[model samples]
Structures are given as C-alpha cells and as structure tokens.
Target: MGMIGKYARLTPGELQQILGDPALGHRLVEAMGEDEEDGRRLDVDKAWHAMSFFLDRLGFPVEVVFGEQEVAGAPDWGYGPPRYLPPAQVRVAAEGLARIDGATLTGAASRQELFEAGIYPDSIWTRDEDALAYVWAHYDSLVAFMTTAALAGDAVVTWIS
Candidate 1:
C-alpha cells in the first residue's frame, strides 16, 4: 500500500506504550542521528511532504514526528508518533500554523502557487485538483491536532504505513 501520513493527539499512556517498546523507544534518537541503535525511519504523508518542502523554503526545519518502523516492530502494525518534542518546538510549530489560511489554500491561486513552487509529488500531481483538494481537507484537521497537542505540551504521534 502507498504511505499515508496521519497523526493523533496522544495521551501520556499511549506515549508510554510507544516509549516502553524498544523498537519504538529509541526512534526519535535514531532519526535525529543521536546514536546508531539500528532502528528508526521517518516519512510524512506524501501530501505533508509538500508542506514540509514549503516550510523548508521558508527556512523553518520542522520535524514533527519521526518513525517509519512498525509500532514496536510488530509485523502487521503501523508507526506511531515517537514521544519527542521540546515545549519550545511545539510552541514554534503551533505558532507557525497560524499562517495557514484554509480558504486561500484550497483556492485556485494557491494551487497554481504550489504547482509553480514544484512541491507536489506525482502522487498528488497525477490526480490533479482532486488530490490537491483532498490534501487541504485533511490538512485542516492535521493542523488542529498538532495545535491541540502543542497547547497541552503533548506530542502528536503518527502511524504512517
């Protein structure tokens, strides 16, 4: 299956399950290249990639979550948001989200702008307007979840499989 990016407002208990599992525990460390523990990978939703690329253009390196490994390395499971995020990181990201204008994002002008910026991958470009609109639709909720997690000083975990 193609990768799908997703995140949730994780509770501390949910985070514990992830941190307690060795496969998941050291994921953030691995992603950030803090060590060579041998188990961590990360991928955002393909749609989210465009947003990340856009952010990179603005010089804001935002790595919201990190992990492409199965949750706990389970054979048939998915990735979960790693329990990581300094309060400052969360604050910065939440503040950055204020720049998202939902109406403007889904409008024709934004589509043209994104296309011009060359941020979209073929997965989105192939479907034309529909996929683009779909990304925006989900983005609204994605930002909301991230914002909520930030407000509570919690991490927004994701399971992209």
Candidate 2:
C-alpha cells in the first residue's frame, strides 16, 4: 500500500482540505506532477516530498534542536544520500505538533526514540474524545512510516496522519 493509505484514509479532497495552505497545495500538486492519465492519488515519492514541503512552510519554528548524540557530519536522520528533504525537518514537524498541543516531552529524543515510541517527542493527551480518538487511531502509523523511511535512508517529513 502507498504511504498515506496505511493510516487514516483520506480522499484527495480531504487531503486538500487538511493541507489548507494554497501555496503548499500548489507545491504538492507540482511535486505530484501533471500526470492526468494516472488518477490523483499522490505517488509515494511525491507524497513524501510534498509532506516535507508542507512541514517546512507551515509557520512553525523548525529550529534544529540537537539530537542526543550529534553524529559528526552524519546526515540528519541518516538518510544516506540523494534525498529530497531534510530528515531534521521531519523531526521538527513531529515535535512541533507536540509543542503546539502543550504535550510535555521528556527532553528531546533522537528521531530513533520518537520512532520507537510511535508518538511525537511531545506526547498527546486530550480530554476531547473525538480528537483524542482520531490521534490515537492514526498517529502511530504516521510516525512509524516516517521513522522507517528515515532509518532506511529515505527523506521523510513527520506529520499527523
């Protein structure tokens, strides 16, 4: 299955709605390319790229919070080479969500730790049943995919599914 298919099923319209920024949408469209012959489901590579782009432009400070052990000169997230986006960007996105929602982090964990936890560095705890349920149902899948991709040398941006 494609990446987005693994988590909460989102129609193209739903994706467009969630990705409310027009510029980001346009960027995603460009990343997806103009292949009219294929239906509009985002290609895996394009979807990954678009996700990264969306995170970078989403009006949050993605400052490079240092990882536990700064592997000297190791490419962030260890995405070996020929990557479309920065792996740090993905961590920033993930942690950014937690930060936004007042979720307390046990200090900054490496991308690996966040991956293993299957949650953002900042945890999610909410009283709103619907919102909490939605997060519980889908966040892990999203985090897992991103973590796996990063570990396997693919550029992936962290985001809520």
Report the C-alpha lDDT of model 2 over 1-161, residue by residue, as the tens digit. 32222112223453344345433433443454545233332123212322232333455454212111222322322232111224455445455544432112222323344334343322322222243334333333344543443444433322212
Question: What are the runs in model 2 whose C-alpha is more than 4 Å off?
Answer: 1-84, 91-128, 157-161
Alpha-carbon RMSD of each model: 9.2, 15.5
User: 49-146, model 1: which lDDT tens digit per residue?
Assistant: 55555445555545653422234443332444333444456667677765665454444434556666675464456447676666666566556656
Counting clashing residue pairs in each candidate, in order, gives 4, 0
Best candidate according to lDDT: 1
What C-alpha lDDT values do all the predictions have?
A: 0.52, 0.33
